[model samples]
Target: MNNKLIRQAQEALIVLGYLSGTADGKFDKSTQDAVLRFRRAEGLKRTNIISQPLMPYFEAATLKKLQTNLKTLGYANGVTGKLDKATIAAIKTYQKNNKLRQSGEYSHVLLAKTNRAAREREQARNRRAPVSVQNNIGTSSRSNDVVISSRNIPSQSNSSKASAMPNLNNRTVQENEIMRSEPNTAIQGKMRILKGSNGQVTGCKISTITISSDWCTSGNNKEGSQCNVLYKNGRVLSVRCR
Candidate 1:
């Protein structure tokens, strides 16, 4: 058995709150018990060995837990199991704040550090007591009086009508042209339109990734009509009707 693999597994288990001892690169009984528990939780066959096939599962589980912790700590906005762009950004921010290397990658060491920080924060919160605020405003016996003077306010109906009219001048047209010339709109315009088997406009297929009608509906395009969607690097940037 590779001691390095065992040590990595132990570190993952520790971050996942399955083990308590140090990861000393030894397949000890404690490590075996932790591995068993993890396996059970993952619904994998009962095994104490950290094989090559099982390593990826451990890494994925550890990453999910780390993402959850970061979300709870306000470092991440969502708990995505994969290391997508948002996850990378969150990891980079967290590393920068903690004075660690901003590699934007996951490792057992990073997971352990994040887990420790979360535990410390939880303990500190538990140690604090709830504070109660008391309102002690005394009643005043002074008479409060107010007087209002009415003044004749002039309203020009011509000015109100002019203000309510829509502006169709050159500046408004220029602003609309500039908005249409944006890079996102240009990209969407350039995307190849896709159709379903029935010849109705369904969605788009950029490279190997497919943006289906469900994604369009999720973006408030409930009709799933002819829509332009901007997608890049496994993320949907924008969705709008053509």
Candidate 2:
């Protein structure tokens, strides 16, 4: 299958909670395993191969699509894309109401129904919404030109505070400015990107690879270098490195 198809499958699987990784258009083992799990859950013959007939199902149920459709169908609270506890609860409630199995799995049928229902709801909403004619070009009516819907606008009180939200770009710029502004120190440091089993960045390093839990210097590279693993969390676990 093409990378596009693989990416789509990965996206669908992710929303369905079968996979965890960015869909970077690669047919990796994680994507294959996700496909297998989905197939098994759906009572289809489980296989690593991305069969032709399964493409549509895989392309369905993307996180954004799921949130949009679920919200439109009144099954979800909002379109946050992330399937947190609230989202899972909403999915369960939807499944119960629809008389479908309450496995909380995002099936092809669920996705298809969601898309259709969301479309219908959008059409109905549009029909009910007020429309306005544009004022003449270069006219002074620009300030008054705006569209308002009759629908209730949800409050953002529950959302994160602006101050609490990280300004990533600003932080990066500030760091760069600081680095450039500061004099070079004698000490220097190097860092390596860490990957999960599926090769996605996990923001941590492999601590140990030996059969025993003891720390050893065996897995050093030819340059006589061993990784001094660091972690965001304090706990350490033994893991195999490829």
Residues 195-217 of candidate 2: C-alpha lDDT, one tens digit per residue: 33432222321212111112111
**lDDT at position 224, candidate 2:** 22
Clashing pairs in 2: none
- Across residues 1-242, which tens digit of lDDT does each residue of candidate 1 receive? 79888888887888788999788999889999899999999999998877878888887898888887665455554565899997887788788878899899988788878878777755644443211111111122322211111122222334345433232231211100001112332233323335454333344433222343323322224332455655332224455653
Per-candidate clash tally: 0, 0
Question: Model 2, residue 87: displacement in angstroms?
Answer: 0.9
In model 2, state the lDDT of residue 200. 22
RMSD of 2: 21.9
C-alpha TM-score for every candidate: 0.52, 0.30
